[model samples]
Target: MKQFTSIAALTGLISLANAHGFVTSPTARMPGDAMASACGQQVEVNQQSDNYGNIQGELQVASGQSDYSASECDIWLCKGYKFADNKDNVYSYTAGQTVDFTVDIRAPHTGVANVSVVETSSNSVIGSPLISWSVYASTATGVTANETDFSVTMPDDLGSKCSTAGDCVLQWYWYAESIDQTYESCVDFTLGGSGSSSGSGSGSSSSSSSSSSSSTAKAETTPAAVETTSAAVETTAAAAETTTAAPVETTPAAPVQYATTTFATQARQSAEPSVEVQTASAVETTGSSVVSTKPIPTDGTAQEKLNFVESILKYLAN
Candidate 1:
């Protein structure tokens, strides 16, 4: 039972470390996904990503050997791990067409991906790979999820290489920012259609005319002509910082309590309608000493004086 528990714990840890992800679009002979149509053999994934390992920095700039090291081919992702059948033109793409590069994410991470095309003849990535055209380059800012999609317009210039080389390779290198890890994928394919031809590869004369006009306009407006003087900039900055601040901390004086006997005085005055009663400021006590300093009525009958005393007392209590 103890041995069984240890084995189970080890298995759980392996499962966590083996969390994987890869490009699921442009169909690059992924594991378990049938590749008999494009590849030579059946590709299987023992680990989520097979022997493909982690790498650091931008793929185009990063220097090191991955699990799929280049003893076989740097352009070919997964190196010797992939099947022997993957060395052929899998699909063809038209130049200048907007393509969506999609990736399946199980173990989502943060990073950017660079998708580019290169000549398969060289199969070399040192210095600069034979990526005749850099299709798209961008950072993965908000990418964390089930699928990451990058819409990139393919470059029209194949630079006379594809004219004779026949086919090219598309490679997507995904590098994780938080860790020293990188995901690499490649698809063997050919370039054809509208933009692939050398004749049409160069843009139309109208585009070139527009580009020339833009350059001339830029040349006309030199930096010295539009520069702001340092003294004027300093003055503006000084004016912005010249702020008059209101007091932040203030101490309001505590309120004073003045002795008020308006209600008692009013009650005393009201009692005078029936009997002559003194005001609150000048009052005299009568009958019981317990009701000290009360405004009692003078020259009043016993019942009238008693009523006046009760009325004043009620107001005074309130």
Candidate 2:
């Protein structure tokens, strides 16, 4: 009986090791009723059991389930987590805001990883990945600190594409080729000040608040000028209203986020378009591992290596 207990414990450890990683902070979407309806009950159950389980593991369960709908499941995207189920957990962010991410990696698997804003309707990346690592969670080097804790700045040029909660997601994608496992976690978000109407409204509110504050201060300074100031304030308010009423037209090109590690999209070539990374002196390829042209010191801790790589990538981007 003691021998049998030992075997059971070993089996449980192996089961735990089979699954790998998931985003822990910013409240990533989890499998739910909506996901069950789309990806089938078995697939949903699989994820519910181990949220860190990869896409390949979910697919293995999906293959035998008759309820799994390929189109509806979208297994390759966000590990098939549905926006409908995650509606209550959407994040509201302004353009150029910085979002910090924390991932819990149960086990290390050498992979390529990136975080990007994805358009849910079409399942395409909105410009480029906010952060990327070509050699991520390497077995040789083990998992690095930055690999689990990182921050990304939201792009200002998303326009109105991500203005709605369900329209887009900040997705973290990791593909481990050695194990043929893909793990994804999505953070539903809406980019504020992107829509013309909403932007104009916010501008108007800010202007009105500033005008009110200024008028109050002026009134406090000179009681005699109260009447004259009120008249001037009315005129200013009228002008501000007129200015805000007119439609604001803006046509700005989307900007790309540069990282030391090239964004790997090759594993997703069939689903996404090729992304190009160019430096002042050299050009890097997408969907594959990127190596720095300069010699990097190999004599440092994992954190130092990450810092050095970032410095090199910044130099190259500039």
Per-prediction TM-score to the true structure, in the order listed:
0.38, 0.57
Candidate 2 regions exceeding 4 Å error are 1-17, 194-318
Error of 2 at 229 (Å): 49
| List of clashing residue pairs for candidate 2 | 266-287
Kindly give the stretch of ten consecutive residues in candidate 2 with the minimal lDDT sum.
198-207
Among all windows of 10 consecutive residues in model 1, the one with the lowest summed lDDT is: 200-209
TM-score of 2: 0.57
Which whole-number lDDT from 0 to 100 does residue 306 have in model 2?
84
Candidate 1 runs further than 4 Å off: 1-16, 31-70, 73-84, 87-89, 121-147, 163-167, 193-318
- Candidate 2 lDDT, 61-157, residue by residue in tens: 6777789999999988899999888765666665655667888888788889999999999999999899999999999999999999887877889
Candidate 1 lDDT over residue span 1-318, tens digit each: 896456345434443464445555555534322322222121122222242433221222112213322333232353322334443224444555444556665554555556567455565442243222222222343444323665555455664444322245466666665554666676544444443222211121111222322222112121112333344323244433422232133486574333333232211111232223334323332322122344466877999788777756754674
